[model samples]
Target: MHMNTYSEATTSQLPIPPTMDEDLENNTEVCDGNNAMTPMVRKKSELVVVANNNSRLQMLRNFMTNLQEVFFGTKLVVLFPAVPLAVVANFYSFGRPWIFAFSLLGLAPLAERVSFLTEQIAYFTGPTVGGLLNATCGNATEMIIALLALHQNKVHVVKLSLLGSILSNLLLVLGSSLLCGGLANLKREQRYDRKQADVNSLLLLLGLLCHLLPLLFKYALGGGDHSIATSTLQLSRASSVVMLLAYAAYIFFQLKTHRKLFDAQEVDDDEEKAVIGFWSAFTWLVGMTLVISLLSEYVVGTIEAASDSWGISVSFISIILLPIVGNAAEHAGSIIFAYKNKLDISLGVAMGSATQISMFVVPLSVVVAWIMGIRMDLDFSLLETGCLAFTIIITAFTLQDGTSHYMKGVILTLCYIVIGACFFVLKTPLIGQSPKASFGVKPSFEAITT
Candidate 1:
């Protein structure tokens, strides 16, 4: 009876189990909590996706803005359409003259764009390295044309075009800059940094010496001597190596040890802000270089046909028209800067280009030709060499004083005009045995037969 009573007491003290209705309410509350968390997680993921899309959109917008600025920032952009036209004309076998004209128009904007891209890049590379970049790329048009001509075995075109570039920079571009600057600042004396001018002049003289030695070597031995021709070719190749080394040294001096000397010609303070990012500028430069190469090929390929159609001598076309057109952008820039009384920048643009062409591009062309098995030498015919010699001497004298006047500009302009006239009337055959053939070397490459 006691055991039964203890069991009953324990059973009475135990709690009761929950009902089905209470259990249903607890389950619904758990389900509600899970449902609420699902929406929050979904919203968070959607926001992340939206942010990613917005970032992509912003990048696309920036790209388009940069593209528009690159393509439409300049007045010359109007000529950009000519690039496609020329391509179409070439594809359809249109007249060579039409292709030539369109290519030239296309090249104008491209050349200007190249300069713009280089300057944009310079914003990141400091003044010294920027100046080096400018010097390297300033005559990119000429360099491309020369390389194309060399590829075609048109050594004469390469020589004449390079020579023309030097002359144009030294006389036409420099003279125009000086004339405009002197007239604009008639009351104030227009002066430039002589140290820079002197360095350029000395380098130019060294290049002249290299050119002269090859020509003299050929002439010193009687014409039609095979041995002499070979020796002259060897001398030219060796001289090219020396000139290249000298140019490298000049680059070092300008960019490293003597950087301060060129600081005076840095980009203007107002113009320091970059129009595009570093990689953007690099992309444009590479793209423009490729386009310039294509247009240059068209130009070199059809030069003779255009010359024939236009009734102009090939020399006149290569030595007069080509340089003027190829360097149009640089010429304009120098003149504009000079007019603003920034003669140092003007001088750097003009003299630096000339010096680079002489000491760098010309020799580089020779080396490139050598590599291609083309027998291009430094023996510019007596006529061309004489013109180069006179132009350099005159230019050296003009820059010696570091002071510029309108009269000095007038003199240089007149000199260019006279040279242009001489070439216009001169009817030297473009297709001939290599200049070395005159010295009796077996003709390895035809000259300007393209």
Candidate 2:
């Protein structure tokens, strides 16, 4: 009954034309806007034009925004060169070691600025290219400092700094990130992907093993004979090449084959999302690298005199102070991300950086020293190697469950403090010198003369 009533109402509302010609005439009137059809079509056409204009404007605005993040963002730190430049000038003119020290310290923020630019570029590109860019210049400040130290033939300092970097990342940076994240989300456990952390741990172990083999060959098994020392050097050289190759392969794994396993989820930071072009980021990366290298030269040149003036050992300067300053940028970044509850990115920055330093920076330093005619072997002091191994083992165990807490962070930090204290009193030994005591006892002048 309802259907029949609705049908009758519809039929009554329709004004049926008596002839086909009359119906055709009425349709024409509607199309020409004698009725509502023409007005509706005009409104739709105007809406399309407005939408097109808005889209083009937005694209232009994004381009401008990217330019600012890439270039202008760097201006804050890039412009910081004036301070270092003056310090360097004062050092040369007045011959002040302190001035030279401060000059390099000033470059720290610039190094961080370069890292930020790469991050912005990564945001514009996908994960693979971002990872590539990051891996390439991952530890710019550390690499530059180590290279300068190697240039001055300060092999002991270089090795200690490497151990310092590894320890700092595995313990200090990772610990701080966990603590901050845990505190940020109190009562909620922070978790990361266990598989990714395990793979990184394994790679770090590989690096430790590579360093360990030469030490075992020279000291433990071969009793530090001259012939054995020579072989150890040869082994170290071979291992450096192998480690570099492995580093390349690992890069392939992270950025290509199993990228998704390690890649961070897309974060929603409005600032990071700023549209920076690839060329712009590349230029800044290269430029910042060169500038940091120049500053590193000045810093290493005065390190010894500064150490003497300040009454600090070269080992302490390199091992503790240098790592903190060199990796300051990435370390701060990781902590910030963790505090914001972005654990994936935080973990990636902390762990990925350690792997890069281990697999890339250490080998590159060895190869560079070799090219410079320095017989820098992989014979680390027993204390350095043992502490490194301990740190790696503890870190692996802590991160295995993929869950983190404030207590875990405290434990890791305490481990770092313990190891750092040990290094503080420890003397810098001539690492490649053989047939000494079990620990890193200083080689006698007779040993050097012979």
Candidate 3:
């Protein structure tokens, strides 16, 4: 009886099949040949995958936020619209004068933002790299304009613009900085590092020597000789190479071996923070440069037309107006720092810019022109070269004592005014024509009347 009961229990437990609903719910597991249940993998839903992707896109939003922070909230930001306006005007063949005006307005903020971006990058790089970056890109507008003019075979424009940059930074910008600084600090003595001033002065003298040699070569050997022109061109090219080498050495001296001498005047401000990432600053700098190049091309193309329309000489337009507009942002920065009694930064902005233009930009323009098969000599004509020489001499004397005052600033500013007035009245033909050619004998009145 016990054996029969056990057999009945075993038979009952042998197989109880699952219901249809239970089979459907439990189908994720499968019974293999060995009767072992194996689990099957399943994919996530489409909605869940899309949610993960959306989260990753937040980086784009962060970039936009940073970009707005960097570009907005400044008075200059209002001028940004002028950039596109200038582009549209250029495309639609709007008046050349309008294009010129819009381009200048557009360039002002770009130049300022360039400086701001460079400062932001400097936060990551040490001051040495920052100084080098400033030296390279400080006069980028001038360099771009000069290169564009050179490409157009407007060598005269290149010479005038570069000369104007040197003069502007040295006389106008520095003079204004000193003036504002002196007025702001009435009781305190305004002083700067003499070593830095002296080094820049010496470099200026060297650049002057390079410039003067070619002019003297032309006149000393008689300009009537064609060989003299060729010789002057050759001399200018050779001098440009030498000047570039000297500038490189100056960079080494300033940033490496003798860096302490240059850093004496920097104020350590703990409050200053970088507003953008290094890569962001770099990307913006590149974009700004490209925009500047486009505007610069417009400026160069329309300069003569603007001059004709405005009743201004091309020389005046290139020398006085262009520099004022191109360096407006930098000029303001130097003055502001000076007003805050940070004379070191002010001098670095003004004198450092001047030195870079003279030693680097001017020479670089010549070298680039040489490569383009253009004869861009260093002989800046008698009038322009004389002004540069006088400006340098006076500036050297002003900074010789390392002490500055409103009186000194007054003198420098007056000198710039005088130079501007001289250019305003001076009438010269466009590039490829001699200044003396314009003064050639005119036809008799009777001949014209006939």
Candidate 4:
């Protein structure tokens, strides 16, 4: 004979007391082992206890995370669950560009908001939380898109996306920032961020090698499609290991030799006054990213659907369209920074973001794609390779002399605008009305549409 119904006092005393965060706050019970509570109970009771414990543990973990955020910082929120949200959003079929555009806008505010949060967590520790958050969100969005592309076997599209993002950050973000900074002062000179520069250059070199190696290897192997993507993934993993080690070395050098480099960050004094602390802001960011990602996915999906109806190539879409959408937010902040005469920091942001992507994001995507049995190459196509080469060359030229001029900004921006126009009209020059399992450039637009 068992009492199925227990009194409130006894129930509270039972090991299976409710375990919600707020609900647990009221409970006076503490776990003290089998002696303190009944060891043998109904299986249902045991399940209840387990559920409560799990919830309590999660609450504790979140609290600990809050404490860490108080001391440390955070990453991009709108992109935290980008893949999942994108998958859902892609199910929608209209207004995709706006969705994607909204996601792009997420970058700037995310950086600004997170920086404020991290600064607060550190008790105004002097680092902008927004920088890392923006990068994180950017990386997350890139990878999610990469995965979707890979899942669809759009290898060329993936390369285009990578190149487009790099170019957007380099030319658009950097150029706009330089333009603003230059206009504020007739002449703008960049100071030496030697540590950051060295790391950036090294990563860029590594990324180039990752791109070059498999491409050359494939060309040597008669340029067959088979295993080209696979080989690229393997090389990406190797490069990731090398570059990660380099980053570790950079961190070590900063710690041991130039500690001030870690601190003495260049932040906007005005922005700082209005910014909230890290954890408080980060909590809000978590919610925002979710909403934004949802929106972004819808945007991408709708655009894609419309594109499918309009017969647009994903490669052209990524190269021209995605860039406009993705970097919209960060570009605004970069321009402001430039206006505030933070040219060096702007260059660092542009170059640093690209270097990190090439060295870390691309490689990690390869590994993750591999694990998921998706083929993601570490290499780029001829056009993509050409674009990367062009970007690096122009970037080096732009930053080489440590001076940024307004004319240069005009040049870079105009080039981007021209490219955008070409993309819109030429439309990746597709061919054939029917979708082919194996992709080859179609001969003409008429062939594609008909």
- lDDT by residue (244-283, candidate 4, tens digit) is 6765665456445765663444564654452344455557
Against the true structure, candidate 4 reaches a TM-score of 0.65
Clashing pairs in 1: none
How do the residues 7-92 of candidate 3 rate in per-residue lDDT, one tens digit apiece? 99998999988899889766644444224422222134556777788877776876886678667935689899999999999999
Is candidate 2 or 4 superior in TM-score? 2
**TM-score, each model?**
0.92, 0.77, 0.87, 0.65
In model 4, the Cα lDDT at residue 27 comes to 51
Best by TM-score: 1
Winner of 1 and 3 under TM-score = 1
**If both were scored by lDDT, which would come out higher, candidate 1 or candidate 4?**
1
TM-score of predicted model 3? 0.87
Pick by TM-score: 1 or 4, better one: 1
Candidate 2 residue-wise lDDT, 1-450, digit = tens: 999999999999999757988888888887667547667888999999999999999878876776566546643456475555645576567554655666656666766777777776787677667756764566777887888888788887788887788788889988988887888889676777787787788899999899899877766553566787789889998998998998889878877798877665446555545456667667777777777777777777777777778766667777787777677777787888888777777778888888888888898888898899997888776667888889899888898887878888889988988877776675444554423643344443444221
The deviation in Å at residue 25 for candidate 2 is 57
**Worst-scoring 10-residue span by lDDT in model 2:** 441-450
The all-Cα superposition gives candidate 2 an RMSD in Å to the true structure of: 13.6
Evaluate residue 353 in candidate 1 and report its C-alpha lDDT on the 0 to 100 scale: 90
By descending lDDT, how would the candidates be arranged? 1, 3, 2, 4
Provide the overall lDDT of each model, using Cα atoms, as 2-decimal numbers: 0.87, 0.76, 0.85, 0.59
Residue clash pairs of candidate 3: none
